[model samples]
Target chain A: MKELSLNILDIAMNSVGAGAKNIAIALDEDDDSLRIVIEDDGCGMTKEQVEKLSDPFYTTRTTRKVGLGVPLFKLAAEQTGGSLDIRSVPVSESEKEHGTKVTAVFNKKHIDHTPLGDLVSTMVTLIQGNPDIDFLFLHTVNGKSVRLSTAEMRKELGDVPLSNGEVLNWIKEYLTEQYKEIERL
Target chain B: MKDKVALREEGSAATRIVVGMATCGIAAGARPVLNTFVEEVSKAGLLDKVMVTQTGCIGICQYEPVVEVYTPSGKVTYVKVTPEKAKRIVEEHIKGGKVITEYTIGNK
Candidate 1:
């Protein structure tokens, strides 16, 4: 609960690191349910790799092998009376691919969760900093949806580096504004 | 607490150094680099000249321990930073206008 956003950031970073050109993130909140989904078009993993991805000690990257990201995501969802699903498909026929899509669903009204502000901030931070990967986000409340595309924001900002203080500050303000609209519900 | 608004209004003239301090950065020795910058800045009696802050992941994990310097005109990103390089940055780049060519991503 405390670090749900951090977990999300870590997962998204993995996608970008996998050479994904496009990433999609969705959060749908209704009176009874909340669904979170992250999909990336990166190099897909083999069945064995997917099986080991959540093992907490398996990773192919040069980074540390303590694979806690997916495990943490799964734990967070399960703890909230939810479930997680991960699917991967290979990019090539001969070579085993490693692209992955993860989805977690929760009964929002029942789960003890962190504030939405933190989640949005984490998402914004991830999206702003990674210009090479495009992010698509959709948030739904009571059947109505508010969608945001990082590509659109990038266009508006005119290639401003996400790490630039001005850009980060602007992203924070944008997230704050969007959350305010959500709160009004 | 100084709100982000107040911090922003003060602008780069306020002289803040933001170090990428996430787990990735820390694993690459960003803590020591950050510490060196802070120590050097204080030792030079330039505490008022700069404010040091830490930020989470910047998405360039391959280039961990990135440091950013913001001035009145623009921002400069120094990638794969190190403690020794950080001290040199404070002594040369911050204190003087000349950027340390060796420590920059472009130079590398």
Candidate 2:
């Protein structure tokens, strides 16, 4: 909640919980606004469920009473003169593909907006935690862009585990370097 | 829970400390707990010796902010771990090579 990356991580966990094998997370930051869009090929919610998601008390989990991920994210975006949108198509729809998409837009210069935080760590953690899940991370800052995909990495890695400390360290460094390159562009 | 399996395979490190970072765990304030562990481990010059990482869910949300320490011998699960407790864990359990009984799951 403190950082945009943390909120992204939190929402991605929900995607994982929804049985998403492929999750695409995109962050677009420019002079005007910072927008994050997370789209997952997971078991999507029904219209009713999507409607109830804005409620702080609404949660599918049986463990605790409330689910704050959606509401908190919505609040964060709203505070920054932005908005949150969630779209989901049910798995039962034969004609339509089943998935969920969460988009949050925050004003770039908003005083209340939190920093991005350790985005490299967040991405590495997600990839390390769920190696089987394919994650595509695209970050575009002021029109300069960089993209990282686990599916591609997995093909290159072959037998080596993604969670391997060496590989994780490499990922962190790779992201940092890529961001620097993008920033320079 | 399933994520831990992938991490378990990366067994090259001498020690592995897993902090729960799932929604439940994070809501219970696991970020600070994780940050503390990473800071302490690095401060102690145990970067190569200890691998501090995170997992999604541990299945027990009630005992959130859960931390699991995997030594070469076995694994110890600690629940309700705070940043303060995380430092003590790094010092006593990780450095001293002794599990802090008071912080172990079900004990606290």
Candidate 3:
């Protein structure tokens, strides 16, 4: 992906494919590094599936093989002297604890670090397709942070789908405002 | 897919344009194509007739950024679409009621 946010969307889609009812994506950025964590209470992968995550990372994401979800994200991180990790617990191990968490740390100072692209669009696109689930997004830059939760929006909108044009506009505006405030601080 | 079926239960429009948005699709520039389709549909006042939506990989990673348009006749898949082509699709296919056969998957 050209931006780290696109990678986040790709991996989050994997969570949705796993039948996750709740998904959380967070970004923590400091002076030297940016950390992205996407955690989902989905049907986790088996140990065998989890073990496949360590395949060698590539330098170029686009020309790499198609249909792969992880190696590309791993490449985005590792190219910047960063790392990626995945922890999954299958339902057979413990039904209550079955989920997957992907943590990717990017060395922001590195020249190869990909920029964080339009996250509002990414979130809106995700919600537009899957309005039935809950998505929680939190981004922290320096000490300031912004948070958005579809669960709370659902509480307010009742039966309205997030894909509704007006609702999506509201979401974009809301996040834009929050981001502006965060950046101004 | 189950997702499209669920979406249809709400109120199926006369036409729908679905964009592929999996890892491969996004890396291949699907987002801009998707946004353009949505914008063009709304711009041409065809929002009531055309529904713009997205889906995960359709197992055609080689043709990343695939777009599927479902009209009353049937579904037509367009491969390797870009924002520019997406505009013409909205204008010719959706608005003009003429299928752009050159851009369809069958063209190749």
Best by DockQ: 3
Clashing pairs in 3: none
Please give the ranking of all candidate structures by DockQ, highest first, separated by commas.
Answer: 3, 2, 1
Off by over 4 Å in 3: A56-67, B1-11, B44-48
DockQ of 1: 0.07
Whichever of 1 and 2 has more TM-score, that candidate is: 2
Q: Write the per-residue lDDT of candidate 2 for residues A10-128, one digit (tens) a residue.
A: 99988888888999999998888999999999888888888888898775556232277888889899998999999999797733589999999999798898788878867876876
Docking class of 1: incorrect
Lowest summed lDDT window (length 10), candidate 1 chain A: A159-168
Candidate 3 chain A: 10-residue stretch with minimal lDDT: A58-67
Enumerate the candidates' DockQ scores in order: 0.07, 0.23, 0.33
Which lDDT value does model 3 have at A146? 88
Name the runs in model 1 displaced over 4 angstroms. Answer: A59-66, A94-98, A111-117, B1-108
Query: lDDT of each prediction vs. the true structure?
Result: 0.68, 0.82, 0.83
- lDDT (tens digit, per residue) of candidate 3 on A31-150: 998999999998887876776655544313432322477888988999999999999988888889899999999999999999999898788778877888899999999979989999
Alpha-carbon shift of residue B59 in model 1 (angstroms): 18
What ranking emerges by TM-score with the best candidate at the front?
3, 2, 1
Chain A accuracy as TM-score for every candidate: 0.83, 0.93, 0.92
lDDT of 1 by residue, A1-185 (tens): 25555556667766776678788888787777778888888876667677877676665455442256687778778876888888988676324444779898876666465434356666555654465567887777776666667777667655454434445556657766876887787
Candidate 3 or 1, higher TM-score: 3
